[model samples]
Target chain A: MYSKELLKGTIEIIILKLLVENGSMYGYEITQQVKNLTKGKIVISEGALYPTLHKLEAIGVLSTEIIHIGRRQRKYYHVSEVGKDISALKMQELSSFLHSLNQILDFKLSS
Target chain B: MYSKELLKGTIEIIILKLLVENGSMYGYEITQQVKNLTKGKIVISEGALYPTLHKLEAIGVLSTEIIHIGRRQRKYYHVSEVGKDISALKMQELSSFLHSLNQILDFKLSS
Candidate 1:
């Protein structure tokens, strides 16, 4: 497991990307997919995940739908039209930041 | 420029690596070196740089030397033995974290 510091500021983007990939996902599903995608290397805690989802919603980058799963309603999240553009920008920033980091770390570039 | 969130928690290691690479470097020199290395893509400001340097020094991950250049004296920073071990762990954590991030972002992995 990596330090919490390492995961800071990044969970939101990952959450956004997963929703885009899976079409739409509920809270638990988002957390589960993140774990599966990274092979359990990155786990999103409940404390961390909800706030990110809510923040994205507040910023209008995400929209949600309430689905009835038996008796309980699950909140499913999906990217808004704004989110696609935002995701593109955020992903670019993240990608560029990683490239800058790689240069400092002297790691060979992949993309 | 990338978001400050992206650069958070990684600056110390960069400073550590820079000192390690150069044997030792004064604060101002360190900032200049980073600017040069990242081609100004990553600029370490004095506010951000000094605190990180001081924290590492306090943690025994860094040690300092005072040297004279003309009439002025400058404090040069270098990694301590403890720093090497810490540096190794931090670098490994950062590297692994980046890899995990790449997997999520679906970016091509380099290292």
Candidate 2:
């Protein structure tokens, strides 16, 4: 697993992007999806996951629905229109950052 | 400027790698090198730079030399043996992360 510090800046963006792309997901599902997608290299603990979800919800970037199944409540999250916009900007920013990083690390950064 | 959050995980490794590759650099030089390499998209302020250098020095991943030019004292930093090993691991981890992220965001992660 990568350090929490390394993962901190990205969790929110990853969650936002996944929700925007996948339509809707519960917290546990998001964690599972991230794990599965990253092939277990990146694990999202519940401790780090819910707070980000809540923050996104608080900021009007996400909307949630609670479903009751067998006396257990599972909250499902979806990105709002605002979230879609934010996700696009975030994806662009991440891409740009990573591209700059790639040049610095793997290619010639000096023109 | 990219958010500090996005840059937090990267600065230390970037500094270490640059110092390893370029021999040694002072704090201000590291900041300016990052700016020039990223084409001003990513800026590392002195406030963010020194503490990280100090932390690396404290951890023995870096060694510092004080060079006196006129009345001014400049501290130049170089990566130690341990830092080179650490830099390799960090670079690999970061590459793995960005690869997984690329798959998730730009390709199919459902395979």
Candidate 3:
């Protein structure tokens, strides 16, 4: 598990990207997907996950659908049209940032 | 330049890694180094950089030395023994996080 401080800024980007790719996903499903995809290297806690989801929804970047899943209704989140635009923009920003970061780290490591 | 929000979580790690590799560096030098190393992809703003440096110093992870050069005194920052330890730990955490992030993003992009 990574430090919360280290995870703070990237969470929204991750969620946005995941939604853009995977369509609608509920909170637990998002957490599990992250874990499975990362092979257990990353785990999003309920504390951090829900607040981000809520915040994204509140900010008009995400829309929620309550679906009946067996015993209860579960809230599934999908990227809004605005969210899709934001996701594309954020992904580009993230890609460039990560590229620069990799360059910095590789230069430092090689030198 | 990336959004300040995108840069928030990763700044300290970048500084720590740079200091660990480059020995001691002053503010402007660090800024310039990042720019040069990243080929201008990443620029550390004074507004964001100094507060992080001060926070790290206050927390005992960094130590400062004031050196007089050409009648002007410049404060140079170096990782202390404790700072070195923290840097190593933070680097490991950052590496894992980035690895996981890449996995997620790559999967999304490929699928």
Candidate 4:
């Protein structure tokens, strides 16, 4: 498991990109998909996940839809048009930041 | 330039790794080294830099040496034994986090 401190900064970008790729996802679905994709190497806790989702929605980068499956209501989140642009921008920033970090860490570039 | 939000989480790891690689460095020198290393792609600002340094010192991961260069005094920082171990741990965490992030970002793995 990764430390919370290590995971703190990148959570927003992770959520943004996941929404971009998946089109839309509910909170539990997002968590499950992350586990599926990373093979359980990373997990997003409810405490961290919900607040970030709400925060992104508050920032206008995400919009939610209420879906009724049987009697339960699930909030599904999708990127807004603005959210798509923000995801692209944030992805670029994440790419560059990781590049710089790799260089600093002296990790052998696979290329 | 990356957003402050993007840079916030990684700064500590960056500082710790630089100290590990360079042995010891002063604040100005560390900032310059980061610019030199990343070729100005990332700049560590004074406002963000000092408090982190002081925080790391308080946390026992860093120790300082005061040196006089002509008329000026400079505090040089080096990793404590604990800091070195922390650097290694943080670097590993960083590597894994980046890998997971890339998978989420759909960045083509160079491998």
In the range A73-96, model 3's lDDT, one tens digit per residue, is 899999999889998888888777
Most accurate candidate by TM-score: 1
DockQ of each: 0.62, 0.37, 0.42, 0.47
Model 2: lDDT equals 0.82
lDDT scores for all predictions? 0.85, 0.82, 0.83, 0.84
Candidate 2 off by > 4 Å: A107-111, B107-111
Poorest stretch of ten by lDDT in candidate 3 chain B: B102-111
Model 4: per-residue Cα lDDT over A9-87, one tens digit each: 6788888888888898999999998888788888999998999999999999999999999999999999999989988
Q: Please give, for residues B1-111, the per-residue lDDT of candidate 1 as tens digits.
A: 678888888888899888878888999998888788778888888999999889889989999999998999999999999899889889888887777777778886464
Each candidate: RMSD to true structure?
1.6, 3.9, 3.9, 2.4
Encode model 1's per-residue lDDT on A3-58: one tens digit a residue: 88878879888988888787889999888877887899999999999988899999
Pairwise TM-score winner, candidates 3 and 4: 4
At residue B58, what lDDT does model 3 achieve? 100
Which stretches in model 1 have alpha-carbon errors above 4 Å?
A109-111, B109-111
TM-score, each model?
Answer: 0.94, 0.91, 0.83, 0.87
Q: By the DockQ metric, which is better: model 1 or model 2?
A: 1
Worst 10 residues of 4 chain B by lDDT: B102-111
The stretch of ten residues in a row with the least summed lDDT in candidate 1 chain B is B102-111
Clashing pairs in 2: none
Lowest-sum lDDT 10-residue window in model 2 chain B:
B102-111
Please state how well chain A of candidate 2 matches the true chain A, as a TM-score.
Answer: 0.91
Error of 1 at B49 (Å): 1.3
- Once fitted onto the true fold, the runs of candidate 4 whose alpha carbons sit more than 4 angstroms away are A109-111, B109-111
